[model samples]
Target: MMKYLWLGLIFSMAAFRVMAFPAQGGCKLAQQHQITGKVGRAIHNAAQAHVVVRANMLEASLSNAVQAGVLSYQQGHKQWLEVHSVRQQALAYKQGITSHELKQFDHKLDRVTLYLCRH
Candidate 1:
């Protein structure tokens, strides 16, 4: 009985930590909402709102990088360089680009674009 009790307590604590994990998994559901919601509907508006909210999320990740001196100006420049290169490549491949690949490329460019706009 005591062994089972101890195991239960350990499991509870582990479960708590697992549940506290960050929101990477959250994005899939959010994206689903964005896709299915009507263009001018309230859920659609909320989906759009998520975009702005997610942008600030970078503050936490980027601040940590900056504080650790990991996100140098050169790194930012490199990001911009990659964005340009990807954009040109994406355009050249426009005819063959699948929606999934295009969306992924756009996501990368969007991140760099936001970083550039803010800095």
Candidate 2:
């Protein structure tokens, strides 16, 4: 009975080690996800600021984030396109763009942020 108990303990420890190793990768991925979230939030806040200077600043920050690998090129490109599109629309309409449209773009950014962080 004692020998059987020892064997079981060894097997369990080995299994735990295997599981724990993958969890370290998971923890790293979680950290990446958090950084991406921060960048996404910054983008959202910049859009909400409704100032041209802030928007330009946002573009620069986004470029840096993408270059730093915080965001993928595809994700950054899509966000860039949306930001520019909204800017153009705001310019075309003196009254400015709608919150609903901005929210939609923000939602896309949020989704991409989560996706990138996970994979």
Candidate 3:
């Protein structure tokens, strides 16, 4: 009777261990990090695109205001010009174009977008 009880206890412990084993491909930490990295980058890019579009629209409205004399000539116009330049840069970056024997402009665009999101 004593031997049978010991064997049953050992079998039960082994079964419990098997049932409690971790899932396949251990190291959940690394997988989680990778998931976070991808999500962060995607969020940053989306944010950059959204902000750039809003800024561009504002610049366009300012230009329209200048034509209609709703805003002073230089004030809103200057702001619009600046935003236009930034929008151009962003568009070029989005296009992934290279110029003047340099690396693609998209690289800088991606960096800027990421920076904006981080801030």
Q: What is the TM-score of each predicted model, taking all chains together?
A: 0.32, 0.38, 0.34
Tally clashes: model 3. 0
Which predicted model would earn the best lDDT?
2
Q: What would the per-residue lDDT of candidate 1 be over residues 3-44, giving only the tens digit for each residue?
A: 999999888766644433133432243442233222232223
lDDT of 3 by residue, 4-119 (tens): 99999888766644433123211232331122111132223533454354444445555544554445777665666656665565455443323431223223333332322222
Best of the two (2, 3) by lDDT = 2
lDDT, candidate 1, residue 30?
A: 40
- Which run of 10 residues does model 2 get worst, by summed lDDT? 32-41
lDDT on C-alpha atoms for all candidate structures: 0.45, 0.47, 0.42
Kindly list the per-residue Cα lDDT of model 2 for residues 12-113, writing each as its tens digit.
Answer: 766654443122122243332222212132234333334333334345545654665556788767766665664454344444445675555445444433
Q: For model 1, how many clashes?
A: 0
Q: What TM-score, to 2 decimals, does candidate 3 have?
A: 0.34
Model 3 residue 60 CA deviation (Å) reads 1.9
Ranking by lDDT: 2, 1, 3
TM-score sort, best first = 2, 3, 1
- Which lDDT value does model 2 have at 72? 78
Give the Å error, residue 40, model 2.
30
